[model samples]
Target: MSDTMTVKEAARLWNLTERRVVGLCREGKITGAKKQGRSWQIPATAKKPLDQRIKSGAYKKQAERLPLPIGISDYRLASSQYYYIDKTMMIKDFIDERPQVSLFTRPRRFGKTLNMDMLRTFFERSEEDTSIYFKDKKIWSCGERYREYQGKYPVIFITFKDIKFDSWEMSFEAIRNIFAKEAIRHSELRNSDKCDEIDKKAYERLLSGQANEIELSNALLDLSRMLHKHYDIAPIIIIDEYDIPIQQGYMKHYYDKIILFMRNLFSGGLKDNRHVSYGFLTGILRVAKESIFSGLNNLTIHSVLDNKYSSYFGFTCDEVKEMAEYYGVANKYDELCAWYDGYRFGKTEIFNPWSVINYFHNECEPRAFWQSTGSNDIISEIIAQADNEIYDRLTSLVNGKSFTTYIDTGVIYPQIKSNPSTIYSFLLVAGYLKVLKTTPSFNGDYMCEVALPNKEIAFVYHKEILQQLNQIISPSIAVAIQEAIFSGNHAKLKDLIQGLLMQSVSYYDSVGENFYHGFMLGLCALLSGFFVSSNRESGNGRYDIQLKPKNKKLPGILIELKAEKHGTEESLKKLSQKALQQIIDGCYDVEMFAEGVEMIYRYGVAFSGKKVEVMADSVSSKETIRLSKSDYRSF
Candidate 1:
């Protein structure tokens, strides 16, 4: 009640460690009053509690009306009020239940770093200017018990994301610079008697290129302990993106060496440091604890597959609904959900927050906005390694499929080999594909059949595949095939088909006599802006080639080819009969079919030892037409 309050009184009022309260006074992160000789006091104003000061209507308006910030650097502003649901109440409880090392793994952009940042803000005491950030925020709404724990501890927060570089020296230097900047910022650490000994000796070792793994780890531990000793507080350690080194190392094939370095570094600082209050670590992958954490036996792990904290790291369904409403796109909620909201972890269903935010910013007209994030490098790798079976699966996905797979974190690597099934599986997990069915596979595994979830991914898939094929197949070959089909150059087409056969793998040998037949089918598949299907069901049998051009009125061609098994004349006659039968069976209307046609021109080509013969017939009037090689070539 008096101007002077003992450390015990401050601890009881704030629900903080007496060590923490005293540390705050020493570090100048808080202020109140000093007793005549030995104890500390609090100003009457400080006794009202921080949360009470934040409850005014004015603060609520300020929090709501603030402009949305732009770019990644401004995520704090945009994310401030978005109340990530309390799925991690257990994680918070875990932090409070006992002090030990904890590791959590989730995929990229899953909010691991954000959760760590929130923890740091909650425990580390802030000056007036910084404390204003939390006024009327969702964390404050948790009530007085949480508020009482605010601004009560010293936190040493480190994120490994910036440590990425092509070389080991660059990575080490980046980490050193980060620690140096943080050390300069902490007043107690900078001004303490041990400051000269720690900074000069440690930094000299780093800059001189003489610090080994053990020395570097020891330096950091010494810095942490010195800060705690000078401030009378054990520090809470938050390590974000702990698996970054492993990821980069794997891609660069420096895994064993980097693992050795990280193992020693982490173990030294986190394993037995008595000055550590607690630790929280997050990464995309979970290396075996024996390999990474070593003797840190107190470590606990939370993974994406675990039901415990799923809602903590991703945007929930209700959050998406609220976002839609907030952005005036409420009507499009169902469409958005169909594309991005099907991922389930435990009881929590989540949508990719990055994609949702992208849609809000672009005001996209109901499409796959997330595909623009980056090229599917892993998918390309899979495709490059795919065999015939894998190729069949890719075709199945494009045509439509009912199978999906969950991708564990570390399973995808930079140089991972591409296969059709693997690429499709990656796409499914990365939000490019969505569930089409919950069918049971033959092996008894429940399969979520998936297809391209939105137009964005479909477009990318089409573009990239076509681009790769274009590079592989000669442009002259592609042009020749197009000219052959459009001009009805059966001889040149037959010759080209033979050439393709010569270049193709041995699998096509059995169907060699039908080379032109298969070539036409392959051409249809290669053409862009046309819906191409082979052996599609007609009235009674199947249509050999069905080409629905992108532009209406541009003639959807249906063709049937024959070999010279019977005589060339008889084959032509048979071809004409078959073409007419196809027109009738396909239900082609002779009148009112299209502008330039009563019935589509049906072509029946017969081949005999490089001497190609063509016969064209009109089904509307029962007309048969034949042309010689010179005339056909001129046409």
Candidate 2:
């Protein structure tokens, strides 16, 4: 640690590879003096600790009172400092058991990136500034083994989520820029012969706004190798969102070319490079290791089904409780857990951190908070391509399902044919669904069946579908239906129904009577605090529509609609008889119902071709039946 210490000594003292020390020097984050023989002398003053630099007053204040780490960006280090979940023990067990390139797949927004970041911060060499992060953290409490492991190894981290391109050239350039940015941050390369060349060339190319993906990847690898040479140690590589490019490439049909280029480019630096220590990668889908890391034999796969390290990537139930208490929302913990905490990654029962943080920040009233993250354009694409079977499953999900199976990621919206299974699978991985059962077979394989994890997710799935459907159908359809129902406008309602039948024939075919039932239900579903029941099984039979207004004083409307392809009168009579029977079967006394509650109005509506007829009746007190016509219209 002396001013005249060699790069090797600095590496030893800092628990870093010679390459990383060199990288620090190249980025100007460290200082070194060169002798006549061309070797650099590392100065103790040049190495500012990570903890000391990053733990400024502003950061400390922010850390002390942060609500929850939602949409957190700097997961590599910051997450550990403020709200680190104890997944290290699990990770350690996994690493101890295997030595291969590991892939941990989960749904999007399930904290995959955060886990990768934690790994990087845990294993990577740190400057003095980083000590502030580990102080008083749980890891330090794990005793000497944990303390001894701090500030160890050189870490190379990358996230492919930001990589976007219309062509291979654009993707290459984007990657190159990322490398250049990282290199400029390390001090060891500032005075290196290779650093000077790469820096000069990179800046010029950047200034010119020119550089392709291949060239950029090459330059980054070359720079990485130079750092490795200088440090005389291998680099630990951690990649996050690794499937992004492939997903995009698959969509754009640039898969073949981009895969070839990316394969060679990443393999050159990560697989072929002699200075690599270990690697970990994460994504929503598990692309075959052979396709990406061809020669890396020591790869370990930790999928969602893997028991080891399942808790490593998500918020556990205890962690959720701690977060609620920390944020002064402990009272709402039960409600919060009911909505968001059913997901089980392994033995750990977890909640969706993104939604949880959003709930706290917004004062804990549950809503579709997760949707604020993105437009879910991929889902839109899937729905547009989905087949009849997929349509049926979606209906089942909306109605409620006890179990569903995970669909293969590849089959999710296959390019050639629309696969319903793919849509279901995507929802499963996207945190919209969770595994409910794992049944083992005699062949050593397991079947993991999933379902909507909680009520919030169930509502979200339905709402998103409605939103998407709104785009495809008339935007005014929902509004028109709502107005018609609230105002009891039989004419407008009939017209809307006829229009829907004309336009949505295929959808009706896909869902049967449930289509009409759900459509009517949707009108009330969007309104908060309203109770709606469709086909509610009773002693005698099911009730078609039972709408209970939020306020008890407001009259609940009971109505039934029937397809009167024969004629309106017959259909109306049948509807009236059914509605009256519902009241008798449920023992609903009209007179003794809540005071100030409006009298129940029973309606029997029937549809025949382009015409709809409405028949209204009121049950008399002395067992007399009184029938009347409110209004009738044809479209």
Candidate 3:
């Protein structure tokens, strides 16, 4: 080999394009390379230079090639500057259907705000040619008919996603500001000769944020009328997260005020309003019972169960596959699917777009990204109100089971407590559960078989759903109980369980073993490094509870619980002993032993009303030896 090589030879050897090799040589990245005339020479033994190009937004040129847009909701910025998934086909669908008023009900962070912004960018007139954003998109290839609508209409856009407030006053102020922002956007109409003088005055008041309650309630209608007169084309109105304030109101005890205001606002702007050419609304719930869309016969709602425009909200299978390939994590597609996929919108299988994008952005490591993005207040409320039946079903879901129930996609906030069965409906709409099968019910609802969506949701379920139990059972007591269990401090564990029982349970809730089983399950479910299982066959019979460690070095745990109906202390001790014997007699340790766990802690717990008794022993596979109280240490 020669001491020096040409750029072409170096390019071949280093697997670089000749242009890149030449640039590297000129930039002094290729050691000992000299330019001969217009060609460069590199040392034969010189290795490929380390890639020093920035991947983050530290430089302008590098920002053009940034990672996935994790939290970006601005359409123009996301579509042009990030690895955007083309959802513009939704525009083509909308143009074809041409519904006068459309409502899209989907869970939060499922791209509602971004899609709304995409509509605003495509429809709103601007001095800058915004057509460039969609010219290379899926909608552009549909036909000139769809493309002709681009940059053609005045747009009134506002998002209530950030309007969460604790009181009606603050919430009303935030909503007023949102309308004022839209009014300012259409400032040209304030001085237009075509707009009526009264309408111009209303517009100026709205722009100045001095509009009264009645004026603000009619803000959307008034603004659209002025825009239509100014531009000679009725403006398209887009409201993103329209139910956010309604939810906040329901949660904060001012439901009536917000509902009244929203009803007036929506009815004026969307119902029988000639000034509005089209209306688009996105939210997590349909909120039908609220009468906000009262008598709006023209309104059409597309929810998670509907097939129309379903694939637009969340990433479809092919989209995720392409994304995985683009990010060079193709081999992790199955893992990604198991964690973020399984969301079925209509008949389209969807992946949580937020988690999927964050999955790739974090180098393909899976996590409960979707759960961490927002408050789970609704979920917490659901768990807080769960009866024994609902808690057991939720437990089944976390254990990889599905159940069939009637799902009213239009479920309202008030039904959460009054109609406990509506919890499934809430779970499905709020993105906590996924439908595996659907049958249209008699009324407008559906009979659906639903389960936790994926590993991410399962993790979220185990954490949030179980953690809410701490409100009844103090968090410190729960942690102490978990520590006692792991450390084999039977005395401490017994006292903690007894204390929790007295403090948390009502007398009616102490009647059966099922209640205690669920209570113990909730506690055991919080174990960080264990895969908790319940009522599973081990050897000859099913075990009440089993805590199998993910790491082999950690000891496994088996629990058998017994509940007595009004018993003396001596009888409770015997009952607890029987529970302990049942564990060994049932051979519950077979599963753990087969999994190569060396040590096991077997526990027997009994309850009589608030009174309780507990017994525990340890087993080692290497030798059948008992762990005396003096031999105990934290593991």
Clashes of each: 7, 43, 0
lDDT of 1: 0.56
Global lDDT of each model?
0.56, 0.59, 0.83
Candidate 3 deviant stretches above 4 angstroms: 1-65, 470-474, 481-635
Ranking by lDDT: 3, 2, 1
Q: What is the lDDT of candidate 2?
A: 0.59
Ranking by TM-score: 3, 2, 1
Best by lDDT: 3
Name the candidate that leads on TM-score: 3
What's the distance in Å from true for residue 420, model 3? 1.4
Better of 1 and 2 by TM-score: 2
Cα misplacement distance, residue 556 of candidate 1 (Å): 21
Off by over 4 Å in 2: 1-66, 76-91, 94-100, 165-169, 193-213, 217-223, 403-406, 409-420, 440-446, 466-635
